[model samples]
Target chain A: MEQQIVKVKNKRGVRVIPGFGLSMGITLAMLGTLVLIPLASIFISASQLSWEAFLDVVTSRQVVSGYVVSLSCAFFAALVNAVFGLMLAWVLVRYEFPGKRLMDGIIELPFALPTAVAGISLTYLYSDRGWIGALFAQAGIQIAYTRAGITIAMVFVGIPFVVRAVQPVLEKLDRQYEEAAEMLGAGRICTFFRVILPELFPALLAGFGLAFARGIGEYGSVVFIAGNIPNKTQIAPLLIMTKLEQYKYADATAIALVLLVISFLLMLFINSVQLYMQRFGRG
Target chain B: MAQKRQRTYQQDIVGDGILAVQKVREPHTEASGKGIRCGLIGICALFLFVMLVLPLAVVVINALRDGWAAYQEAVMDEYTVRALQLTLFTAVTAVAVNTVFGVFAAFLLSKFYFRGRQILAALIDIPFSISPVIAGLVFILTFGNVGWMGDFLKAHGIRIVFAVPGVVLATVFVTFPFVFRELFPVLNAQGKDEEEAAALMGAGWFTIFRKITFPHMKWALLYGVILCAARALGEFGAVSVISGHLRGKTNTLPLHVEILYNEFNTTAAFAVSSILVILAVLILIARTIVEWKKA
Candidate 1:
């Protein structure tokens, strides 16, 4: 048994594929140049600022407001997407309706559409004189150039993430559990909440995280509608741009580093939760 | 006593008959089910129409608000044409570079086992989470006037930041993961058994790839390429940062739209946007076809 184990280990070291060296070289080289080195530049530049100065730059009144606006709007947008996207995914999977295929196809429109174009078009649609905005205007509610407009733009870009994430999992879900719940005298709503929802929680969470992350980092679409109001509608990404435009590279890098760290932490949290859920589901 | 027992037995029979009738009516509950289904579908349709369809329609309507002559002039304007050329060039170059890298990276992750393999896989996804503005900013920090390579590049008379190369680099960075993300799953699912067998039979690496693996992944590769191209074409924030808004030089189509819109040239901006709208629609149609074929 010991000899066999040793032999297997030795054999494993000699990969049968001939291009391993070539593939690894290209992967590392390109990843270094395009991703790693460039990302490291943010840190390197940011390190120039002392901790106090970094704190001062990131925590100033305007910067803090940018974070507030970005976080709150992203949170609202992600929440809205979680509910609406689930509906769309459920409808697409369960129903045989007219234009179902068309609906399914266009879910990715946000992904394909340019952010700038979406920005302009959404800005136009929600502006006071625009078709949809005109109705809201009658109620004395302004959407364009406000937080409401920013949230809507975030929703537009984030719509696809949730729907796409939940779709395949929803499709693969076994109907036996649902039927069993029904047989046990559970109502439709009860079965959905107790059985179906538990099964969908992981996908839903993943979708929510992705949408939230996208919303936080989103720029082009939100910028046009945000009206660039300094203390109010300014998003964190736009703040970074504003700093870069002013040639304040150190300040820009400091803010970007903070945003990047937040994103990384969020990703790590989501990934670990997913890993845990998979293990629990298996057990 | 016998008459009372008979009456009780008759009542039991009547109760059972009524229960049977109810059981037979169970399937008719679909009437209410149909209503709920219609309502859900309606909500979805209305949501999509208000959120997505209307915005897209507005682009076309506003673009033509100034009539065909003006629309034609905006699209055919010298600067607009120049921006279009720059957009196409950046997209093509970025897609070409990333496609090559993607093939290599996907092969490395899926085909081989190594230490830190998972880390490598996760690292490729960094771009997705990073903001586009950061993406451009990173390049500036690396190659800008005050950057690490600034002295070297300047000494060599090489310009990257605020030039065409910077635009391409930023686009490439943002789009780096798309092709790899798409291709990895397909290749990983294909497994290495066939390649292993081919190698044992002394087939060359290129031969094994061409005859065995390439056929399986061609559709996925094309799908990835289309996605990459679509993204590369429309990238704004990243390109905007590094391009320095050099009119007729570094301005891509999306930046051009911003410039036109900012200048109160609403007609021209919408007209330019209409071109991207058309491109986006074409991409959508192409994506749908690829998805159908893949499935």
Candidate 2:
């Protein structure tokens, strides 16, 4: 037993900590219970219906429209957040103006604010006769109770993901690289384009993926602003809830299964990019 | 010599072409004096202010309206209070469980290298990407009376769906990654030297953990707890499906807000949502400070 322990230690490199196996077993068990088993059963329940039935449920007009709205808004919101969040993170990390720390703290407000509050607040801000909404109305721009409203709510929640993800990368990037470029007679814009952006590209992509993923799955914030109009403003998650409430378990599971595939594929794509970046290291 | 050369080079630029020159030399100057950069910062400041601060200000203003007796009545009503309690209770329990499970998982993943460990590590993040609505449905399919485990749970009279336990379960699923995400990198970076030192000092595992590991993990754990709490309180997708929206029973604050909004009680919805918004803001501020401290 002692020799076996020594062999295990040799294989591990680090000395074997006591209880590691026990903890591993417990961890796997917990993950299986809370995550894997539950997720698998979604597919299982979904599979109970015939493939034709599954297709019909998932591809229903309202459900399809919900998907269109969710994916399009999430995509647009994530793109907007990436562009603007990068700029915001750049300002926070590279500048030393008054209220900088306060500004930094405010960047995470979306993460902390409950989605319901975020949704309602956005609605309040953009609803006709409301502060910003009245101004938009004067400009003939309708936001509240429309796709624009959904996108706005999504942007409100999604910005923090990009800012938080990109901030550290920006902060840790050696200023020496950009400074060296400046010393080589490269202009500021050229230096940013050539030196700074390339290094930040992978992190920015990761942030975009995260923000997009969150937006796709988002329900709480969008529902208030969406007006929950079927075949129009309704989101995919809300559709799933509708099916469930209607006691169509198989239908709900099938719709969920479709969403699962899309979200999983998108996340997998992002993860692959992240892995490539890790392997290549800040190129 | 490099510093002197760089400064003089910047000065030479100031003498050469003002616009391009100032832009090139901007990095060496006091950050405040960077003209276009300051304008860029101003734009960023405005965006964050309008998106985050203004929405929150509206919530607070609505919450603090002293003479809005109807709104106050809505916020403090029996249904409202019960919903808030349910929300808090479920969130606290879920976060407490998540912390324990997340720490153990993080420790196992960080301290030990095993086959499939990387796979397990990646799998923890699925909940983050997985639609919460899907997550909620899975729970229903797993623990609802007709679900796989539902029969067993029903036999034992242990209700999982449409109850507080259902809310806790879904909250756990959604917030599961926070503690692990926070701690895993910290543990991996810090390594096990202090733990080893404690072990060599004749400290048992529990003693070593309590004295050594816990101190390092406390702040991360607290941050994770706050995040989990915020997620739990705000989670609408999963909780709404599982809660069945029993007015004074299973309804959480988020669900309450939804229900009130559906009822067209806009003022009440804002009032209830504002309290959660304040909690979220406080938690975010705390997380930012802790993160800044770590930096």
Computed on alpha carbons, the lDDT of every model, listed in order, comes to 0.89, 0.83
Best by DockQ: 2
Question: What digit string (tens of lDDT, one per residue) describes model 1 on residues B1-295?
Answer: 8788566556645553555444344522546568878898999999999999999999999999989999999999999999999999998998898889989898888888899999999999999988888899999999999788889999999999989999999999999999999899999999887877788689987888789878988899999999999999999989988999999999999999999999989889999999999989999899989999999
Q: Where does candidate 2 chain B have its weakest 10-residue lDDT segment? A: B12-21
DockQ of each: 0.47, 0.52
Deviation of model 1 at A151, angstroms: 0.4
On a 0 to 100 scale, what is the lDDT of residue B206 in model 2?
73
The true-versus-predicted C-alpha distance at residue B67 of model 1, in Å, is 0.6
In terms of docking quality, model 1 is acceptable
Task: Please report the candidate that would top lDDT against the real structure.
Answer: 1
- For model 2, residues B5-115, the per-residue Cα lDDT tens digits are 576666655643555555566656745447878798889988988888889888877666655786678778999999989988988888888888888888888777778
Interface RMSD of the predictions, in order shown? 5.0, 3.3
lDDT of 1: 0.89
TM-score of each: 0.93, 0.91
